[model samples]
Target: MSIKSEPHAGNLCNLQDRVAVVTGSSRGIGFEIARVLASQGCNIVLNGVSNESAIEAAAETLRQDYGVDVLCCFGDVSDASVTADMAKAVFKKFKRLDVLVNNAGILDDGLLGMMTQDQINRTLDINVKGPINTMQAFSRLLARSPSGSIINISSIIGREGNRGQVVYGASKAAVIGATYSAAKELAAQNIRVNSIAPGYIKTDMISAVPEDTHQERLDSIAMKRIGQAEDVARTALFLASDLSLYVTGQVIGVDGGMLI
Candidate 1:
């Protein structure tokens, strides 16, 4: 199941006729972002490390539900060549790009003193270099779009830092840094870039944490509850659409007031 370049239905406001590429969207937060964007009338390009079939299924659901175009590309975004290929595939179908959400990332938990080189490299490659490479590959189309936007997914640990996640935190922190610099450089071309730092979201990524550990995290949030995928999805939609036109180069935490 793949979406055609042109939408098969009428356009809507905010994201009408816009095209958005969401990496790591097979499930979890990325999937929700694609869903919300499709509902807003944006054509979607879906990407993930593996699971081509799953991505295709998700795309098909979006197509059926929203009457919008949806394309699925499978590959490891951490690889520069793969990211370039993903961009090319997207342009081949859509002909133009309006928004990009670099949401693909991996986590490796270990004490800093005991972390291995492979863990460090893999975490940084997927969580940090992936966005940089994707942005570079897609900048041309974005520069020409009417509403060019780039939204990078960071984490609260990136800003506040955390134990047993030094490398992962570092990678997310790097994402914020890239967002700041890219926003400054791309603003002239009408390409808005920003980062979202989420905390303790109930995703597969955090399921490994013990119940007590998770509770501890929830207790710290001012909202006194965990955030849902929709929370981050809403934030992504804002940055991807005109709602955040005057906002860029900023790290907005979607952590239920956890950062506050």
Candidate 2:
């Protein structure tokens, strides 16, 4: 199922003509990751819960800014049908997929006892099941590429165990489990699987935190600052490129050593 790399042969970071499917990529960390990958000449697929027009606009930006082919798959990744349909479109357009970034996730903060079943289900569906669905749908396409990479976005809360984020933490932890299992199972296909656990990234989600609590987070980080989306995006670039061909079944922390 392997296709030789003609466009980017022997290049360390060049992803020219390669296809990347990034879930929840309309904005924030997902979009930045897709954008960085696009800068390296990869044909980009942007998936998100945003409306069709918004997602299309994001796609258009990539096409215009990087002159790379961009596809917008507007739908929630939690829906299996969406990933299936996106896979079909991607295979039809590019015939293969080199990288799949599972970046779609939600943060519903609440004590486990106070959380509604719907909240719990929604978080798990998007954060955990979404990656499962995308991996299943795109595995074949990815296996066909000479270099296949799966970068799953996890969070520090998954390992650090934050209060009021029990379910969110559990779901992210589950993602790490999936990464380990997939890396082992898919190694035979030369597909490298890894996870990134970001801590207090300055995104729309982080902006929602209370000012005092946000400062408290800043104090906890050795770097004494919040992270930017670009930080995670660049880490993803390394994983997606030949630079990390030998890396798999590992969880990289992009937390600015916040946990330390």
Candidate 3:
């Protein structure tokens, strides 16, 4: 799809001609982020893992609704080979990559004692290694852009640590650590790296929590309401746009003051 650039109407950040790749963006928070970025004039690459039809539908929606070019790239973010190919396709199609949102991750919640080795490895591979793989693969393309932004979607459990989220928390913490290191390394190239730690948002992932546990989580939030995907999406817009030029290597929480 081709979209001619239009005059931006308001003080919202203008991201014309920019290309963004949002992994695991077929639905949920990643999808909302992709939509918001497309609205801001970015050409979006909607990525998914083994879901060609879903990813293609998402791409089409962005193309029709926002009139922005949308590309569909499907593969597991944990595999370096897969991400390498994804990068090649992005560069082939867009010629430039301005933003990369490593939003692909998996959660296998269980007590450390009950968690099998396979479960632990799967969580770490997807939640931690996935972002690292994509970052390494896209670094060269991101370097070509005048400004590049990398947003890693983390979780509140990663920071505060819940009873059943031992391995998941560790993986998310690793993401923050990677963000700091990557930000320092990429600063010279004018590429910003940051992580967004979302609280108990109303996504399919959180729906797995038991009803009683879920209620307790809701009561703990300062806002007393579950966060919408758009809440986190707006923060991503700030980081992706020039508004956050000075911001890098930080973990912004979208958990409705639950961390406080």
Task: Choose the strongest candidate by lDDT.
Answer: 2
| Clashing residue pairs in candidate 2 (N, C-alpha, C atoms within 3 angstroms) | none
Model 1 weakest lDDT span, ten residues long: 5-14
Query: Which of candidates 1 and 2 is the stronger one according to TM-score?
Result: 2
Winner on lDDT between 1 and 2 is: 2
Candidates in order, TM-scores: namely 0.93, 0.95, 0.94
Off by over 4 Å in 3: 1-12
Q: Each prediction's Cα lDDT score?
A: 0.90, 0.92, 0.91
Q: Model 1: what TM-score?
A: 0.93
lDDT of 3 by residue, 1-260 (tens): 99998545444477888999999999999999999999988999988887789889888998999899998888899999999999999989999999999998888889867989999999999999999999999988999998899999998888888887899999999999999999999999989999999998888887778889888888999999999999999999988988887899999999998842
Instruction: Name model 1 segments beyond 4 Å from true.
Output: 1-13
With a 3 Å backbone cut-off (N, CA, C), the pairs that clash in candidate 1 are: none
lDDT of 1 by residue, 117-191 (tens): 998999998999899999999999899897799999999999999988899889999999999999999999999
**Candidates sorted on TM-score, descending:** 2, 3, 1
